[model samples]
Target: MTRSVALFATCLGDQLWPEVVEATVAVLERAGCRVTFDPAQTCCAQPAFNSGYHDEAKAVARAFVEVFERADAVVAPSGSCTAMVHRYPELFRDEPDWRARAEAVAHKAFELSAFLVRELGVVDLGARLSARVAWHDACHALRELGVHDEPRRLLRAVAGLELVELRTGESCCGFGGTFAVKFPELSTAMLDHKLSGLDDRVDVLSAVDSSCLMQMRGRLQRQGSRVRAMHLAEILASR
Candidate 1:
């Protein structure tokens, strides 16, 4: 049976790394999913939620649940945004009615890697790519979703893909949505520490969140480093 999945392209995803969103659609189709995208869907409201704007965040998150509440399964290439969806129920604590809706939608929501490996029992995508790759934990994906091994399992199955372990693979890239904006200096410092582990052994740095990739990629480009930052979906969709 083909699972009909609603693709939740996070706000940053559609704007910054549109190619990654395209890659996600291609990958899900290969995994036997009938993918649907609702352009009416908007932000997950993570930035506002994280920045202590509960009322504004709730408004946006309410719209989000309204769009995806009917989905059989909603998958996003972003761990950060998916993590925010998991917290939607809490965002509507006082409203029992909306909270119930949020809970149902959150339960069906999944990060890309976890959906493929754990839910779908798919580890390999028959992808071919020759390059040394490192997986970044993308904070929310690791701590919130407990998605540590799923991405690695899928990447290891890719032919000619050398999955290397970075010394600080699990560290934050300092791109915590608005967290990077509020403290630019501290953010750059944390990002520098995160990228200090990169070397010639790894050509591509892949993570489940595009926000983290954008943060690191900007620093790498400014420093004239050839290290490429890619979303996990892009690598998985490769052939």
Candidate 2:
């Protein structure tokens, strides 16, 4: 049976980097899943939720559940946003009916790498990127989704791609949504700490979440580092 998966292009994926969304679809299709997208999608409301606005976050999450509950499975390029979906049930924990719906929908959500590797049981999509790449673990993807090896496994399968450990691979990139805006100095300090670990051998620093890439990319560009920050989907979608 062909898997029908919906792509949740979170706000960043939609406006900031549509290419990541496109790349995600390309990779999913190559892995034999029929992908669908709903234009009704919007922010997963992580910002409001993280800031402790449950009522506001609940309002947004209700719409998100409405849009995606019917999908047989949901896949997104971002582990952070996918992690937000995992919170819907908790966001509505007081209401059993909404919680039930949220639980059902959240159960279907999957991060791209995890879905590609664990759900589909397929690897080696014939992706070829001749570069020394190191994977950066997006905070929510690592601590929330437990997605440590799936991305590495997929990257290792790519032809001519060398997967290396990013010394600060597990540390937060400090792009906690609005966290950076409110604490610019602290965010930069954390970003500096994360970047300090990237050595000269790496050609690209890959990560599942574009937000983290954007955080690192800004710093990398400002400092004139040659190591390109790329979304893992973009790297995997390469031929």
* Every model's TM-score: 0.98, 0.98
Cα lDDT listed for each candidate = 0.92, 0.93
Model 1 lDDT tens row, 152-231 = 99999999999988887678988877778889999999999999988767889989999889999999999988889888
lDDT of 2 by residue, 83-177 (tens): 99998888898999999999999999999999999999988899999999988999899899999999999999999999999787588888898
Error of 1 at 186 (Å): 0.7
Clashes of each: 0, 0
